[model samples]
Every structure is written in structure tokens, then in C-alpha cells.
Target chain A: MIKTMKALIQREFWEHRGAFIKAPKIIGIVLLVTTLIAYITIRVTSAKVNGEAILQSGILELKDMSLENLILFWDGMFIGTSTLYFMVLFFVMYFFMLGSLYDDRKDGSILFWKSLPVSDAETVISKILTAILFVPIVYSLIYFVVLILLMIFYSIILLFHGLNPIELVWSPAQFIKGTLVMFSGTLIQAMWALPIYGWLMFCSAWFKKRPFIYSVIIPAIIAFSWYWFKVLTSLQFTNISVFKSPAVYLGHAMFPYSNDYMGFSGIQFNDDSEAQLSEILANLFASVQRMEILYGIIFAGILFSVSIWVRRYRNTT
Target chain B: MTQMITANNLSKSYGKFEALKNINLSIGKGKIVGLIGPNGAGKTTLLKAMLGLTKYTGDLEVMGVNPFKDRAKLMEDICFIADVAVLPKWISVDQVLDFVEQTHPKFSREKAEKFLKKTKLGKKQKVKEMSKGMIVQLHLSIVMAIEAKILVLDEPTLGLDIIYRKDFYDNLLNDYFDHERTIVITTHQVEEVEHILTDLLFIKDGEIVLDSDMEELTNQYFEVMVSNDNYDDAISFKPLSTRKIFGKHVMLFKNVNRGELEALGDVQRPGVADLFVALLREEEQS
Candidate 1:
């Protein structure tokens, strides 16, 4: 069973290598090039305009800063770059789940897949697992590698200037902490995004024509109809649960380490920057354990089962 | 004891349009059964139900397994080729092989690879890069490697040219078919498969018009070419269908005495294609 599942998931990776493998590499290259160009532009502008001394004084000032701010400086830069990756990961997974089941049916390959000894449940679960677990892991690992390469680029620039970067750059680096937060944070993101992912997969299997359009339009129509009904009945708009329900899930899913689903608050980062790694990690794991998330998970389970059932019978668009 | 596919009053309908109407079938081991039908004649629908790809009423069993209830378990011993070019265009030759090796316990990687080596297909060739014939060859290679008990093919060579179409069935018969295996094929190119089919099934109007072995068909159906003088006598016996060829009346008769047919004209056994048309026309007249 395990071997079958591994093959099925590997099949998913092979089928969607563009989204899983190439997308991350392209994102990494664009980010690295943009960073390099920006740094070079800043250096040339500063040196040509006689502002090099000001830039020099900035690096010298980092030496005099306290350990706390120095660590914050390193973390702020690391997290800033890593933020784009997690953002792209969400969209990559969204589209991956959307097409995972539908593409095969459109191309008539669903018959080929169903001809095998693997059950529909295993195939659908492999798709879910690919969206939730495998893609996130691949994106996170690439993000980490890009971060390391960016830091190494900085080290080379410092060495070119005949200065030791260890005192300012590597000394207060949050390598382990940043790696832990990004990898663990992406998993939490996927865990919170289950309901939305479930809807995508369900639509992928269920809809005969334009599953993407129907997946979005059907929910939009429901929310619109319910809002207008409430507004017209009471002569004032009061109940927005229909609109807010999916918003809450999407919000928490899009932004990781937010408040509990019940609380409906956004990320807890403050100006003081006193938050510890453990505090944020604990908050993320704790927030998804709430009853609200539990309900969402139950809803997701129902959709996933229906997705498998639909895949069993719906061999074509 | 032969493991046979048995269907009891099997019926399938899409809305008001019945695709298959209470069709009962019993296909036994070592027989190559050709399910010949016209468009929307329920041939594909019946094959789908047999392969567990669709829902139907009544009981259907393949090799003692309820196909719809336990398709994956049944697929362990039964395999199907739904159509030509159904294999994913994005999948590479090597990747699909690796996947089948991992997923199907009965799949033999070495056998598939050996068959592949005999062709010009490189390991890294994707289905998209290969021609229509190559894709069919690759699909056949993987299917042949698995020692399945029952093989179901639904128009397996629909779009292929004459050479590829002939090659497709030739490989299937020579390398795949055996006493331990049962093969059920549905095709419109009846002439190619008529020589190979051991049993013949003719379905039309969502019902099985005729189901009998090839030998039984030879006994039941006789086609004769009668001259203009014998045409009136041939018509008296009520031929199932009459088509004019070479200014002679070529008639298809059902269950007529062979000695009388020989006396009337030059008698010959009818092909499944001719028998099918005669049967379909008979259904229409009734």
C-alpha cells in the first residue's frame, strides 16, 4: 500500500513538474537577479553621488548596535525574502489542486489511470498529499537554498571590499531558527488551508465544464444571494457570515501564524519585535487546533471523500 | 472450471436514453470475443460496465469479482485499454514503467523494457513525442507485461492506419492471448478482427441482437450469391438482407438449410460484419 501511494504521489510530481519544480527555480532566479541589480544600483549611486561615506557609516553602525537589534536586522532581511516564497507556494498549490483531477479527464487519460490496480481513493489522496505535503516541502527547501545563496552573495561582496562579514552578517544569523520557522510555518499554512484545497479538488473531480469558473462562481453566487436576501429583509445589512466564512479560511490560509480561527485576528507581529521563535511556532500550531479549524477539517473530509467518489465515476469532462 | 465474466440482466440508461438494456453475458476463458456494434449501439457502454468504469443495474461479475464494487481488486487480474492515445501525453516511457512497477504487483519491468527495446522507443520519450502507433505500442507493451486473466479493449485502435491497426492485434494475439487469459474486444473494423475472433457479439439499439461463438455463427448464418434466375427462389426463403453485387443478388439467410443454399447459388459463410448488418436490419424491420 505504501509503495503504491509513493508511486501515485511521484506520478503527481511528474505530471506537474512545471508547477512544483520549475516554478520555484524560476522564482528563485528572478529574486536573486532582482536583489543583485538593486544592490549594484545602490552601490553605484552612492559612490557616484558622494554618498558612499553614508553607506559606509551604516555598516559601521551595525557593529555598535545591541545583540537584540542585530538579530532582528538579520531576521527581518531573511523573513522579508522568504515571504515571497510562501506566497507563491499558496498559489502554486491552489492551481495544482485545481487541475490535478480535471486535466487527466480532459485528455482522456483518466481511463488509463482507472485501468490500473490502484483505487480511486489512493489516487485522490495522493493528489491531496501532493498539494499539501510534497509541494510545500519542495518550495520550502528551495526557499532555504535561495536564502543561503543570498547570504553568500552578501559575504562575497563584503570580502571584495576587504571586510569581514562574520561580525555583522553571519554572527547574528538566524539560520537554524529561520529554517525551522519557514518549514514548519508552511505545513501549518497547508493545515489551515484544507477547506479551500478540498473545494479545489472537489471541483476538479466534480465539474464537467470549466471547473475553475464554476468553483469560484458558485460560491460567489451563494454569498451574493444570501447577502442581498438578508439586506432586503431587515432593511439593513447585519449578517455577513456567508461572505465572512470563506474569507476567514482564506485569510488564515494565506497568512500563516495568525490568531486562532475563533479569534479571527491577523498575524500578531508588533513594533517591539520581541516575539521569540517558540512563541510564533507555538501560536501557529495552537491556532489550528481550535474547534473552528476542527469543523473546517470535518467539512474538508466530506469534500475529499466526495472527490474520490466522483473520480471513480466521472471519467471525462 | 473456467473463470468467466457473467452478467445477469444488466441494464444501463442515461436519462431516458438506454445505453444497454438488460443484457446478459457469459464470456469464458481462452476466448477472443469481438463485440461489434454501430455508433451509440451500447458496445462501449457494456464494456465500460464490464471494466467497472460506469454504473449499471443488475448483477455483473468478472472473474468472480463484482467489477463496480471492487474494481481495483478485479483490476489485479483484469486489465483494459480504453482507447488509442488514452495514455497521458505528459508521461515519459521510463516514468510510466517505474510507476507501474511500484503500483502493480504483477507488472514485470524487465518484460516491458524488453518489448520496448525491440521497438525504436527511447526510455525518455514522452507520449506527446511519439506517433499514434508508438503510443499504442507502448501501451501494449505495459499491458502485455502484466499476466492478467481478462483483457478488455474498447476500440483500442480507432484512429490508427491500416498497418498499425493490423500490428496492434497481431501483437496482442501472438504475445498476449493464452488459455489462461480471456480477451474481449470491441471494434468497428470487423474484417481485421473477424478472422481472429473466437466468439462474436452483435449489439444494436441498446440490446444484444446476437451472441454466439464464431462456429455457431457459421452454422446459423449463410450468405449465397444467386443469379438473376435464382433470385425469385432465394427471395422465397426470406433472406435476412439482400444487397446487389456484380448484377447478382447476394442474400444473407438465417438458419437455412446449407444444402438448399448450395443448390440455389454459390453459398459461403457470412462474415461478422455482414451478419451484423443483416441482424441490425432485421431488428429495424421488426
Candidate 2:
């Protein structure tokens, strides 16, 4: 099993490393340069403010001597760049994971893979692991390295400005805390997304032409039609007691238009102080509830199982 | 005794058309079988059905495991090289080799590397960059690296040049093949594969019309050539199919001995192509 997983991981990396390195390099450079320019601009302005504190009422706050402010500034950069980068990475990961199999089947490369001493279950599991774990971990490591450099550079700017570097350094504790929350949250969320990947694999096996479009369009159609019917009936039966019930009220009453499914439990956010470890754990658990990981795993299993059957019984000629 | 592969009453239909009709086949261990048919003869469908690549109402087994039910396990001992160049264009030969090494318990990197060297496929070259012949060689290298007991090659030499085609079979026969391994090759190039095959199975319109051992088949049928002067005399032997060439009649006949054939015309061994043509002609008549 360990050997199988290793092989899967190696193959995923072998097939994808070129795209991986290229995707992050451009994005990384843009973020790195923009961050440096922002730092230099803030430092020059803060120096001027220090010379004329009497003229400036606010006295150029984070632009001057605070490391926490600089860290926030960097986190802001991460929030924008990493999210987009990770999303693209995830999309590409899915494409390659599902598309590799699809292309192999379409062109008959899968025959070679299937003939080996690897099981269909191993193949499916490797794909899921790459999507859920490997891709994200690689991207995260890249982002983390860039983030550390920005943090170090921010501290140096403060030291040169006659401020204590220790006070000016970004709080490692806060970064760690935030990373833990996001990592745990994302992993749990990935389980829910398993069905989508499974559906892709299922599509890989069943459809001979335009699998990408069919996989997305067919499932979307099914889900959309179901949702459409519900909306239609819900509108017709406006007075239905079920719609007004507490479960519905908690789910849709407070944010009828918004898709936020968390159903306001009065959680508030301020900073690292507000995001206590205990509360974050509670939220993580709450976020997990909304994910339905087991159901999604089962769905993934069913789709993958069908794919295996299709693969086994598929026409090779 | 365990047979290498078996398909019991395997029947497949595509909506209204039956692609395979009540096919029952059993290939014992250590035999090299040849599957032959013309276009749309269901040769590929039978191979696919055996691999569980298509759905069919039949009981199929490879080494006692139903390919559909025990696919992953069944695959551990079986390898298939499809007709087309199916290796991923995004992968280099090295990457594909590494992947096989990792995924297959029986995959030998040394074997793959040796085969690659022998086949003249550079490890660094991407599949997309390679020519059609090279792609086939790369595929063969990866497949040959695995220690599988049951190997299926579907038109393995299709579209290949003479040298590559010969090399492909040579590698299969010399490096990969053994008495412990059972191979089934489906091809239109019957003459090329005739020397290597132990048994021949001919499919026509989704049914097996002829399945016979090579020696038995050869002994049962004779190729007879008759001059126009004796063509009328040769007609009485129930020739399977006949054609006129150089003012002489060339015919293939079954259940005809050389001693009996000398009374009318020259007797000789029928080529695999001729044998297949005769079998197909008989199928058409029946």
C-alpha cells in the first residue's frame, strides 16, 4: 500500500511539475515585487512622518514601527495571491488527475497501466490523494517560503528605521494559528469535494467524447433541475409550514439571498486575540459538520467503483 | 488444471446489434493464440470483453478471477498493449518508467531501462516528441518491464514500419515471452505472426468461425494449384475458394491429402493468409 501510494505520488508529480513550477513562478514574482515596493514606499513615508510628527496627527502608524501591521499587510497579500493560486492549482490538479485517465482511456494508454500489478482501487485512491493532499501541500510550501521572506524583509525595514526588530517582527504565533485554522478547514472541505472528483473519474470511464463538458454539464443539470423544482414548489407553497420551520429559519431566514450556510451562530472576528484556539477548534468542528465528509467519501467510492467496472468492461478496440 | 483465460457463453450487444454471439473460449497456460478477422469481425470486441472493457452477458475468468469483479487483482497478473499509441503525450519515457516502477509490484526499472536501451527510446524524450514508431516502442518497453503471466497485444504492429514491426515481435518473443506466460495477439498481419502462434481463432461478424491448433489446421488443409488443363478436374475436390493467376487456378481445400491431390495438381502448404481466406470463405457459405 505504501509503495502504491508512493508510485501514485511520483507519477502525479512527474506529469505535473512543469505546470506547477511555471504557474507559481510568475505569480510568486509579481507578489514578491509588489510587496517589496509597498515596503519601500511605506518606509520612506514613515521616515518623513517621524521628522514632522507635529504636522501629522496620526503620525504614520504601521508605515513606521509596527511588525504586526507589516505582517497583516503581508497576510493581505497572501489572501489575494494564494487563494487565486491555489484555486488555479486545484482546478489544474483536477484536470490532470481526471484528464490523464480520460486521455489514457480515449487513446488506449490505460491498457498499459491496467495491465500492471496495480489495482483499480489504487489508481482511484492515488488521484484522490493528489487532489486532496499533494497539490495543495506543494503550493502551500511555495507560498509559505515567499511569506517568510516578506516577514523577514519587513523586520529589517523596521530595524533600519530605528525601531526594535523584535517588536517589528510578524507574530509567528498568529501566523501559525491562522495557518492551522485554514489547513484544517480546507482539508475537511476537500472531503466534501470528493464527489466532484469521483464524478470526474466516473466520467473518465463512461464518456468517450467531451468528458469534461459532460461531467460538469450532466451533474450541474441534475443538481440544478432538482434545485429549480424545489424553488418552483417553494414559491407556489409560500404558506407551507416546513419553509417557516426553525431548521429552514436557521438555514435561510437570516441570509435569504446569500449562500452562506453557516447560519449565524454569533461568531465574531477581530484578530489573533479574537480567534482563540478553543473557538477556532469549535468553528473547525462546525465547518466539518457542513462538509458531510463521510457521505462524500461514499459518493466518491460509488463513482470510482463504477469507473473501475467501466474500465474493466470497456471496449478496447 | 487452471486455464490461463476463459470466456463462457460470452455475448455482447450494442442496442440491437450483437457484437459477440455466444462465444465460449478457453486458452490453457503457455499457449500463444492468434485472433484473426477482417474489418468489423469483432476481434477487438472479444479482446475487450476478455479484459472486462465492455459489458457482456457472460462468465469470463482470467486465472480464476472474473475480470469485471476482480479487476484490480486481475490486472496484477495481466498486461495489455492496445493497438494505438496510448502513452500520455505529457510524459517522458523516464516518467512513465518511474510510474510503472512505483505502481507495479512486479515492475522492474532495470528491465525497463534495458528494454528502452535495446529499443533505442531515449528516457528524456517526451512521448509527444517521439515519432509513431517510437511511441509504440516506448509502450512496449513499459509493458514488457512488468512480470505479467497473461499478456494481450491488440494489433501491436499496426501502422509500424517493417523493421519496428519485426523488432516489436522479436522483443515479445525473445525478451518478454516464456512458456509460463500466455499471449493472445489480434492482428490483420497474420503471415507475420503465423510462425509464433500455437493456436488460431478466427472471428467473423462477432462469432468464432474457426478455432484450431496450428499443426492440426495445417494437416487438415492443403493449397492446390491447377493448370487450366486440369482446373476442371480440381473443381471436384470442393475447393474452399479459387482464383485464376497466370492462366492457372489456385485453390485451398480441407480434408485433402497430398497423395490424393497429386492426381490432379501441384500440392503445397497454404500461407496463413490463404488459410484465413479459406476459413472466411467457409464461414460466408455456412
Candidate 3:
């Protein structure tokens, strides 16, 4: 089984190299240019306006830091870079998932895969693993390197102008920490959106119609139906019990609010400067544990099962 | 000999319609079997059912395991290539070869490389960039590399030109097939496959109407040509069918004496295509 799976993974990687590897390089060029532009923008604007007052108010404090400032800086750099990268990232990854996989079925490429010694389950899971794990990790590393180069250029500009060196200088440890956080958070985002991946695979297997449209429309119909069914059930039964359940209502939105609500407790009202790092780590761990990861797993498993079943029994002729 | 495939009282239905009704067959190893049938005659469904790609009731086995329930285990010995070509389009030929080499225990990448080099397709060409015939050749090369016991090919040469089709079958016979391998090919091109087929199966509306070894079928049957004056005398032989020619009668009979057949005018062997058409015509009449 291990040997077979190894071969299967190799096959998946081979088939996706064009989309996964070559396409990323093209996008990386765009990312590099954009990062350069942003770096130059900050340098030119700062030189023109001489925003030295803003830099030297101890506001760029390296020794003394506030949580709000840290978050602001982190969100500013990370989210801005991440959003641009992900736009290219998801397309590079998901396009192959769409074209190589779903297009193969439509164009009779499934015959080649199905004719081999591999099973349907092995084939579909390899696709999911490629989309979620392999593609993102490699692309993120490339993006990280480009970001580092851009930061150095930004720092050079500041040093050339004889501004305060404290704000411009970067700790390598901080860079490493920020990259690690980006990698972990992006993976979490992928995890949260697994149902979408599974849904795509299932759509590939199940429909002969335009797969892209079905991929979007089918999910919308299902969610709408569920919502309407809940509404009708609540009206007819008069108990309103299902709607009253926090788990049922809370799960629908894009991001979970439970963690934010936990962070806003009464003790947080009194802002204490000396809260222990260990305590903060404990809260973060608790939040990670509470994340509804299992629901994603179960959703993925269900969709995977359906996709496998369909591929196995479908009338190819 | 152990039976490699057995379908007993098997039936398949789609919605309100019956696609295959009560099929019973037992096929074993060491013979090349030809599955010939008209359009919508359930040839593909039977193959799918045997591979567990389609659901059916009753018993069916390939290499002592039920094909539907034990598909993964059965796949170790059996390989199926459906009518349509299904190669992943993004990969190069070299990558595809490497992938197949790693996945299948019995795959020989060296053999595949040799075969590929002989063909017009090259290692650098992607599947999407290649022509349909080249794609078929590539698919055939990869499948031929896998040393499987039971090879089920459904319309393997469907879209190829005449030369490629002939070459496809010739290569299949020469390089890939032997006594250790059992090949069951489902095709409408019966005349091309007639030379190599050891056994013949005729399916009509999802049921096996004729299943027999080639030697027995040939020996049991003869097509006799008789003069117009002796047409009624030829009628006494109870032939399968008779067609009127230019001032003569050509008739097909089963289990008739050689001398009696010769006493007419001339007795000749009917090609597999003729026999298949006659049998299908017989079904339509009934």
C-alpha cells in the first residue's frame, strides 16, 4: 500500500508541475515587481515628506512595544502581502485542480488514471493533498524570499536618507517568526476552506455540465436550502429550538466569532502591561483546540467518499 | 482450469429499463476472447460490471474475487481501459512514464520507453499537444508496460485510422499477449480481430446469445452455396439463415454433415463479421 501510494503521489506531482511549478514563477515575477513598487513607494514618500517626527517619537520602539502596535504592524505587512500573493496563489493551485483533474474527466483523461493499478480514493486524495499542502508551502517560501528582498530595499532607502536606524533595521528572528506565522495561518485558512476543495472534486466527478458554474451554484443552492429549511422548521414547529442553538447559527458565517468574544472578557477590560507570555500562549492553544477542525475533516471525508463512489460507478460510455 | 470470470444470473437495470438481463458466463485464462455486439448491446456494461465499475445483481468474479466488492484486490491482476482515452493532460510523456513505473509493481519503464521511442510521440510532448491517435498510442504503450494477467480493452481502437488500427492489434498480439495473459476485447470491428480471437461471445440487448470456442463454432457451422434448383433441398438442412445471390442460394447451417453440405454446391467459412451480423439480424427478427 505504501509503495502504491508513493507512486500515486509521484504521478500527481508530475501531472501538476506545469500549473504548480511553472505558473508560480510567473506569479512570483508579478509579486516581486509589486513588492518592489510598494518598497519604493514608502521610500520615495518618506524622503519627500521627511516623516522623521513620526519615526522618532519612540513610536518605532524596538525595546518597548505595545500589543496594539504589534498587531497593526503585523496586519499591515502580512495581510497586504498575503492578499496579493493568495490571489495568485489560489489560481495557480486551484486552476490545476480544476483543469488537470476536472478537465481530465470531461476530456476523457480519467480513462488513463482509472486504467492503472490505482484506486479511485487514492487518486482523489492525492489531488486534495497537492492543493492543500504541497502547492501552498512551496509558493509561500518563494513569497517569503521576495518579501525579505523588498524589506531590505526599504531599509536601504531609510539608511541612505540618514533617518533613525532603529525603525528601519529588522531582526532576522522577527522575520523568521513572521514567516512562520504566515505559513501556519495560511495553512489554517486552507483547512477552513477544505469543503470547497472537496466540493470541487465532487463536482468534477458528478457533473457533465459546465463544472465551474456547478462548483459555485451547487454550494449556493445547498446553503440556501438549508437556511430556508431551518426557517420553515422554526415557523412550523414553533419551538425555534434549532435556530436557538449557538452551534448551528454560529457555524455559517465565514469566520468564527467565539474566539473574539472570549478575548473580550471582563478581565481584558483592565489593560495590564505585565501579563505573562505563557498565559497568552495558553489562551492561543485553547483557541486552536476549540477551532472546529473536526467539522472540516468530516466534511472533507463525506465529499471524498461521494466523489470516489461516483467515479467508481459512473457510466463512462 | 480456474475460472477468471463467472457471471451467474446477473442482471443490470437503469431506472425502468433493463440494460442486461440474466447473463451467465464463465471465462478462464489462456485464451483471447472477443466480445462482439451491436450498439446498445450491453458489451460495455458487462465489462464494467466485471471490473466493478457498474453495479449488478448476482455473482461475478475475476480471479476468484467479486469484481465489485474486491475491486482493489482484483485490480492487482486485472487492468481495464475504457473506450475513451483518459490521460492527465498537463504532464509530459517522460513524467507519465516515471509515474507509471513507480506506481505499478509490474510496470517496466524501460519497455515503455522502447515502445514510445518507436512511435511518433516523444518524451517531451504533452498529452494535450498530441493528436488523438498519438494519445491512443501513448495510452497503449503505458498499459502494455504493465504485466497484467487479465486485460480488458473496451473499444481500444475506436478512433484510429485503418493503418493505426491494424498496427494496434498487431502490436497487441505480438508484444503483449501470450498464454499466460487472458485478453477480452469488446469491439465492433470484428473482421480485424477475427484472426486472433480464440473464443467469440455475441451479446444482444445485454444478454449473451452465443458463447463458444472458435474451433467448435467453426466446426459446428458452415455456409453452403446451392443452385437455385436445389434451394428447397438446402431448406431441408434447417440452416441458420439463407441469402439469395445471383442465380444461387447461400445458406448458413449448424451441425450439418460435411458430405451433405458438399452435395449442395460449395461450402465456405463465414467470416466473424458476417456471423455477427447474421446473429444480430436473427435477434432483430425474433
Candidate 4:
């Protein structure tokens, strides 16, 4: 089973190299170029002013900032970059999950796949693993590499300005901690979004045409119609609103670190108080509700089973 | 002889239409069985049932496994090329080889690569980048490399030129088929596959009209070509079907003795394509 799943995951990567490899590399290149252009512009502008005085003042200002504030600033930069990465990641995975099964069927390649020794359940599970585990892990690794490249660029700039690169930038403890935090945060976010991925996969397997319509538009319509029906009839059929309840849950789960849920109140970058960064990370991770995670897992499990069932019986031309 | 496939009272339907009606068959190992039928004649339905690609009622087993229930397990010893163009168009040849090698315990990557070396296909060429003929060649190479007990081909040479089609069958017979392997195939070009088939099945309107071994077919059925003067006498034997060719009347007889038919006019064994048409015509008339 592990062997088959591993092969299946490799197959996914082969098919979607553009999304898994090329897109992240392209993003990295674009970011590096933009940073280089900005650095050159800064150097050109700083040369017009007294370069030595400006560099000295910048060094003084960096020295004055507390280590906690520096770590926080870097953390914010990491989070900001990750936010952009996740936004692109979401669309890439969403469309990939939506089209993965449908494209095979449409092109009549599903029959070839079905001829293999692997079961339909195995195939679907491999796809789920690819979306939830492989994509994020690969993306994070590439993002880390890009982050390191950007840091090297920063170190080069600092070296030119007569600042100690090791002292001002490369804090080993913080870097390792931040890397761990990014991976854990991305994984948790994936778990939170499992239901959506499951739904898209189910749609991909089941729908004959236009999986987007069936997955997204149909659900939206059903939810809205249910909402209006409750309002007009004034009868409480079910305690849970089909759409609104999950929508609210998804909103909260997606933005766990939002101020409304987990206000960063305890972590102070004050000169005297040395806030433990681990505590802040723990608090952020804890803000995700246990109940919501449970529900998400249950929902995702059911959808994944349905997707497997669909794959078993779906006949492609 | 070991039975490769057994079906008893196997039937399939779609909505109000029945695609297969109580099919009962047992195909033995080492024989090439050709499934022949017209369009919508349940040939594909039966193949799909056997391959576990479709659900069917009644007892059906492939290599002693209930195919629909344990398709994955059954597929380990069975390989199929449902069509010539079923491989995903985006995958490169090397990737396909890698996947098959990794997933299939019986697949030989070295053999597949060797088979591909004979073709003009490059290892890095994707399916979409190759021509239709090359794709079929690539598919055949991969399929032949798998050490399977049963190999099913459904129109495996569809849309190929004569050279490629002939080459496909040649490779199947020479490189793939052996004493231990059984082959079940369906094709619109009955005559093309007729020479290679040891057993023949004729389906019409979701029912098997005729099922017989090639030797049995030769002994039991004959086509008599009678001139205008002998045509009236030949008609009395109740031929399955009759059609005119040039000035002679050709009548197909299912069970009439060859000696008896020879007394009417020139008699010979009918080709598979001709026999198929005659069987379907007989079924419709009945």
C-alpha cells in the first residue's frame, strides 16, 4: 500500500510539475529580481546623501532596536511573504483538486489508471495526500530556500554598509524556530481547509462536466435557498444553517491569528520585558478550536469516502 | 485447461435498455478469444464486465476473483488496453515507464524500454507530442512488458494506418502471447483479428448468437456460392443469410454438412466478418 501510494504521489508530481515546482521557482525569481532592483535604487539614493553618515545612522538604529522587536519584525516579514504564498497555493490546489479526476475521465485516461493494481480508494487517498501533505511540504521547502536567498541578499547589503551580518541578521535560534513555526502553521492551515479540498476532489470524481459549477455554485445556491426558506417559513427545521454555520467556521479557521480571535496582547516587545516567542506561537496555534477540527476531520472523511466511491464506478469514454 | 474467466447468467442493463442478457461463458487459458458484434451489441458491455470496469449481475469471475468486488487484486495478473489513446497525454514515456515499474509488481521496465527502443519514440517525448500511431506503439510496448495471465484489448488498433495495425497484431502474437497467457479482444475490424483468434463469439442485441471454437466454426458453418441456375435448390437448406456477389448467390449455412452444401455449388468456410454478418442477420430475422 505504501509503495502504491508513493508511486501515485510521484505520478501527481509528474503531471503537475508546473504547479508543484515551476510556479514556486518563478515566484522566487520574481521576488529576487524585485528585491535586487529595490536594493540598487536604495544604494543610488543613499550615495547622493552622505553614504557613510547614513550607513552609520542605520547601524545605530539597528543596534537600538531590541532583539525581541527584531525577531518580531522578521517574523512579520515571514508571515507576510507566507500569506502571499498561501493565497497562490490556495488557488493552485483548489483548481488542481477540482480538475484532477475530471481531466483524467474527460481525456479517457482514467481507464488506463484503473487497469493498474492500485485500488480506487488508494488513488483518491493519494490525491488527498498530495494536496494536503505533498504540495504544502514542497511549497514550504521552496519558500524556505527563497527566504534564505533573500536573507543572503540582505547580508550582502549589510556587509556593504559595514554592519556585522551575523549580529544584525542571522540569529540561528530564531531562524530554526521560525522555520518550525512556518511548517506547523502551514500544516494546521491545511488541516483546517481539509473539508474544502475533500469537497473539490469529490466533485472532480463525480461530476460529468463543469465540476466548478457542481462544487461551488451548487453549494452556494443550496445554502442561500435554505437560508431564505428558513426566513420566509419562520420554522426551525435544523439548528445548523447549512451554509452560514460552516462559512463562519471557515472564516475563523482561516484567520486564527486575527485580532478578534487571538489578540497579541501578552507578547510585548517592551525594552524591559523579554517575551517568550514560543508562548506566542503556542497561543496562535491554540486559537484553532478543537471542535471545529473534529468537525472538519469528520466532514473531510465522509467526502473522501464519497470521492473514492465515485472513482470506483465512474466510467470514462 | 485452467479457466481464465467464468461468467454464469451475467447480465447488465442501462435504464430501460439491456446491454447483456444472461451471458454464460468460460474462457480457458492460452486461447485468443475474439468478441465480435455490431454497434450497441453488448460486446463492450461484456468486456467491461469482465475487466471489472462496469457492474453486472449474476456470477462472474476473472481468474477466480469476483472482478467487480476485487478489481484491484484481479488487475495484478490482468492487463488491458481499452483503447489506443487512453494513456494520459501529458505524461512522458519515461514517467509512464517509471510509474508502471513502481506500481506493478509484474512490470519489467527494462523490457518496456527495450520494446520502446524499436519505435521512433524518444524517452522524453510526452503523449501529446507523439502522433496517434506512436501513442499506440508506446501503449502496446508498455502493455506487452507486463507479465499478465490475461490481456484484454478493446479496439486496440482503432484509427491506425494499415502498417501500424498489422505491426500491433504481429507484436501481440510474437512478443506478448505465450502458452500461459490468455487474450480477449474486441474490434470492429473482425477480419483483421480473425486469423489470430482461436475462439470466436458473436453477440447481437445483448445476447450471444453464436459461440464456437475456430475449428468448430469451420466444421459447423460453410458459405456456398451458387450460380443463378442452382440458387433455388440451395435456398431449401435454410441458410442463415444470403447475399449476392457479382452474378453468384452466396449463402451462409450454420450446420449443414459440407458435402451436402458442396452438391449445391462451390462451398468453403466463411470468414469471421462474413460469419458475423450472417449470424446477426439470422438473429434479426428470428
Tell me the interface RMSD of every candidate, in Å. Answer: 1.2, 2.3, 2.3, 1.0
TM-score for each prediction?
0.93, 0.82, 0.81, 0.90
Residue range A236-312, candidate 1, lDDT tens digits: 77777666667767766776665644325645665668455555667767766767678888889999999988888
| Per-model lDDT | 0.84, 0.70, 0.70, 0.81
Q: Every model's DockQ, to 2 decimals?
A: 0.72, 0.56, 0.44, 0.72
Model 4 CAPRI quality: medium
Residue A204 deviation, candidate 2, in Å?
4.7
Candidate 1, pairs of clashing residues: none
Per-residue lDDT tens digits for candidate 3, residues B1-286, read 7677888999999897788999999888888999988899888888988887778888887888888776666766777777645676677898888777766778888888888888988789998898767877887887788889999989988888888899888888999998888999999888899899999999988889899998998788888888987888899988788888887888888889988889898997777877877777777788
Q: What share of the true interface contacts does each candidate keep?
A: 0.80, 0.85, 0.67, 0.82
Candidate 4 Cα deviation (angstroms), residue A152: 0.5
Is candidate 1 or 3 superior in lDDT? 1
Error (Å) of candidate 4 at residue A20 is 1.6
TM-score sort, best first: 1, 4, 2, 3
lDDT of 4 by residue, A111-225 (tens): 9999999998888888888988898898889888988987788788778767777776787226665666556656776777788888888889888999998887877887878
Task: Give one clash count per candidate, in the order shown.
Answer: 0, 8, 5, 0
* Better structure of 2 and 3 per lDDT: 2
Candidates arranged by lDDT, highest first? 1, 4, 2, 3
Worst 10 residues of 3 chain A by lDDT: A249-258
